[model samples]
Target: MKKTTSFVSIGTIILLLFIHGCSGCKKEAQNLSDSPKKTFIGPFMNEDSILLYVQKQLECGPRNPGSNGHSSCKEFLINFLKTKADTAFLQTFSSMVYGRTYEMSNIVASFSPDKKDRILLCAHWDSRPFADEDETPSKRTLPILGANDGASGVAVLLEMARTLSISKPNIGIDIILFDGEDLGLSGDLNGFFQGSRFASKNYPLPKPKYGILLDLVGDKQAEFRYEPLSQQAHFVLVDNIWSIAKERGSPYFIHETGNSVSDDHVMLNEQGIRTINIIDVNLVGNISTNPRRTYWHTSRDILDNLSMQTMSDVGNVLLDFLFTTSDSVY
Candidate 1:
């Protein structure tokens, strides 16, 4: 996805505020009550397993749309999720990008399918078709391996799914692996988020209450600041997740506000899902002090740049929030 100054209009912002205000009042009243919080014990996210999942995706090569790697990875993800989740399926559609009509599918896996209260966790599984950000102009046309950009988030969720299969959470969970997220050329917003736009329009039953999107999150130097769009769309969700990270003494989840990103979560928020993104803000945009910025959309985005410890931290935080947090908080 590309960076943008603003996506939501003033009128839309006001409507969102009104909607959130009504719900916020009810949650506030619930928070005031002296209800005991639930305690959850589950298997720890294995760092080795997380690394193995990332390696498995990279083994499929660059999963760009219409490529052999994309086809293989799609089957692998679907088959894997089907074994772990209560229900898993594909949402298929065709879209024309850069004058080419490509078949794409969003891999969706649901846990506790009958539960009314649920949350969403998602990541793009498709790698960029071209390394537009490569410093070597000659290499710009090649596809990126996307170990960090694509596979990392999916790897974390795969591990989460494995753990959830063993120990179910109180609330339902939907893990969606979005396709064609990086098919866009630089500055071409319409080419991006193809899967999210479609999924938002055709939501599944037992819709999620809120969502947390993971992107550019497995790099060794990754730092997650409060993304502006996420903060504006769902401040409470952001605060709660960040608070959990801090309580765990995490060095990655910084409390300061960061850059605005136009990503898949934007599409979900537009559909009134109130989703937030947990991304390495500096690495995605043009400016950054981190060296990993050079890897964005570049052929250098390989398995060497990923960090299993970083992925585990993100997964642990989500598990804590999902299992321990009271039902009323959601």
Candidate 2:
């Protein structure tokens, strides 16, 4: 049953490509006392908006990069982002999977494109084709809905984008929706992180100083343990965000480090972008955190598995992070 849980991590795989780097911005980090604007309003919070969005994607069926569902979902996301961001573009690229050629599009949305100081917030949009983690063998071939895993993070970012359009932030923001993340072939390190790898390699002019990547953050018991690679690369940034989460009394954000995960942040770090990953991998409780939670990568990763409270907590913390920065360069 746990065999699926041992599936390779995207972070571990991307670290091999980390040898390629080249960059930081000097922005004053403000404390909560000094930055009273740090206060965030939860009234605009709409977890259901995200839930509905996830349902819309699922209704298109599993969104593997080459599938019809993938094409339709990409259109939906691009159209929605156009309504929010100052500029939006679909970065089409080709990648090989299992010796077959397939095309993928990474959705890019920019806020305040002219601003020199910026931050990146990203999440993968592709759904895994194999529920390789499901306990039942019969379920392995079936596609995952990826409600919490793929859609939840994007949902939060989309909401934030909408809110930003209403009330502009001090700094520029880029919310990138990566593709081909789950296509990481077993034992093939180079295959994973396709979208991020492409973005980092050929970044649109004027890259941000730092970034935050969100993944699997809507679980009912969502507890964001500090990803090791993120912490190692950007401790101060990690500390700032976690401190805000703690101050807000958010039950979903945990201070401890969880098992190291391999996600899109690895590619950003490799390109010299100090990127942190915010993920919910249970590290607490008496059970061994080694293999981590049981629900991960399973067919159980549907809407019912998510918690609205968790989504709100993460949303508010990100809002707080944005507002706290009076200076443009966070």
Candidate 3:
């Protein structure tokens, strides 16, 4: 969710591993914008329930690291996941970015942990502290609401969590809610993806078959593209997902080229997990703002800019992929 310069989080579990030097230790661990066309009638995804999750996150306020909102949001997610996941734990980490130290946690919820094969679904929960891309310079210091930027992805995942919990999937599932992801400045890849980097270097669970990252998939006119790195890293995997998107009748899953973002998926792929990201880089363009779509990392990234249909499109597509795709490919 950090402003894209075309590329790229850590949490506490890895920090303890470093301090204790334990190998057998256990640990825990975006955006709103999308546009989906066609009548996608799916029993698996509930738009109203998904939208409610987004509203709850917004009611907690901006979840920037070290803030009360962040703390409350973390508790809410863990509590909710506890009801849905087989096991849930917190992966905490600390680091210094831009000369300031911040403490953060990555929430990990495991489903069907006994199954060897798994799929990773990830999204960052923290909102940008500075509206660096705001049109108004005076409002640049204000925090972003992240309705489409942060909560959209989570809302879809939360709905999926509930769905999968009630009716289990064949393969194991791991949904990672990363922290400190939007804390970096544009083009500063190292400062961003703190939680993901830690997860990559210190995988708390079995390596997933592959991963799908959802970001900015809640916009009214959301569209997804084949990321350059994802295409380069896993050719057939890209085709497989886009094909599923197509088969699911998701107009937002455009099988075209997209900007090479340094997001959470990039870190996972770097860890040899072969993950792909499905994000809507063109959100603010279609989102109606006072001066057209307000840019990312802006003060205008509030809940009013989101759409429930967009959430359903992305969520239902992933549901189909998970139900249909096989582990033999990965």
Candidate 4:
């Protein structure tokens, strides 16, 4: 009877253990099989150090093309880039807006200048002078802080300069902090992407093998879906980046392709360079004010709403790609 009792107790223990194992397996499968997952890694962990730097730009007031803030920020940027880059230069040009010619500056920072093979990373640092997305028409003419729209992309590139300045990646990297991307009108549908157009036209260096343009990347739950044109033009680049995103476990890096956006990359593509825009295309119904931050071009685009997490997610994928990219490809 003692032996029988012992066998019964052992059987009960085995059944319990089996049930627990099956439950755990089911949970793991469900979690692992889900689409639209996000990832992170060591490189992105370092991005926190740069969020404040981005915020400081927002604090400098509106960096509109012709304002004192814009002039002051240009000086600050030239000084900052000089420290992290082997060479930094300003590309100046004039464009007529509403019959008034405005002087625009495109800040270019280069790392590993000696390496012939290079990749271009760019973002427009200028804040939009109008808050067209705002409900109030009066505020529509006011300049926006552009914390996420402008600064987030700049912040990532700035950190990239700081990081690569020391480590020195195998491939040459050009961080083109573009200007005047947001100042445009529908009457002339071609008014946007000014910096890229200028840079592509007057690239002092050999055309980079490829370019990655970042914009509006600071949503708390940001989703980076592949732009349709990018998919068609630079599918491999898109695929590689998506693979890295999957490996990193970042929440905002979605696997599916989203709508095609005509942004800074369009000019580069038109110039015969392979380029892709890594924009936040999570503009669904009501996720934000206009769904994807309808507050986009508004005064409401302040630092308080910016998420350090989103910055980290983008920075991680960018850094990994930069350091790991092969020189032969270029």
Best by TM-score: 1
Q: On residues 211-288, what C-alpha lDDT tens digit does candidate 2 reach at each position?
A: 999988887777788888989988878887887787677877788887777779999899998899998755212243
lDDT of 4 at 9: 65
lDDT of 3 by residue, 145-207 (tens): 888788989999999999988876688999998888888877677888888888888887888
Best by lDDT: 1
Computed on alpha carbons, the lDDT of every model, listed in order, comes to 0.86, 0.77, 0.79, 0.77
RMSD of each: 10.5, 13.1, 16.1, 9.8
Q: Which of the predicted structures, 1 or 2, would earn the higher lDDT when compared with the native? A: 1
What is candidate 4's lDDT per residue for 1-330, written digit by digit as tens?
234336646765765676677985755545444433323233443656667678668767789889887888888787899998999989899887677677999999988888888898888999878777677888977888888778888888888788777776678888898888877864454677788788888886767889888898887767788899887778888877776677667778888978887788888898888888888865421244444365566767777667888887787787766666434333
Query: Residue 93, candidate 4: how far off, in angstroms?
Result: 1.1
Task: List ranges where model 2 is wrong by over 4 Å.
Answer: 1-44, 283-293, 326-330
Model 1: lDDT to the true structure:
0.86
Q: Estimate each model's TM-score.
A: 0.87, 0.83, 0.84, 0.84
Candidate 1 deviation (Cα RMSD): 10.5
Q: Kindly provide the TM-score of model 1 when superposed on the true structure, using C-alpha atoms.
A: 0.87
User: Which ranges of candidate 4 are over 4 A from the true structure?
Assistant: 1-45, 283-292, 326-330
| Model 3 TM-score, all chains together | 0.84
Model 2, residue pairs in steric clash: 10-262, 11-262, 11-263
**Which regions of candidate 3 fall more than 4 Å away from where they truly are?**
1-43, 283-291
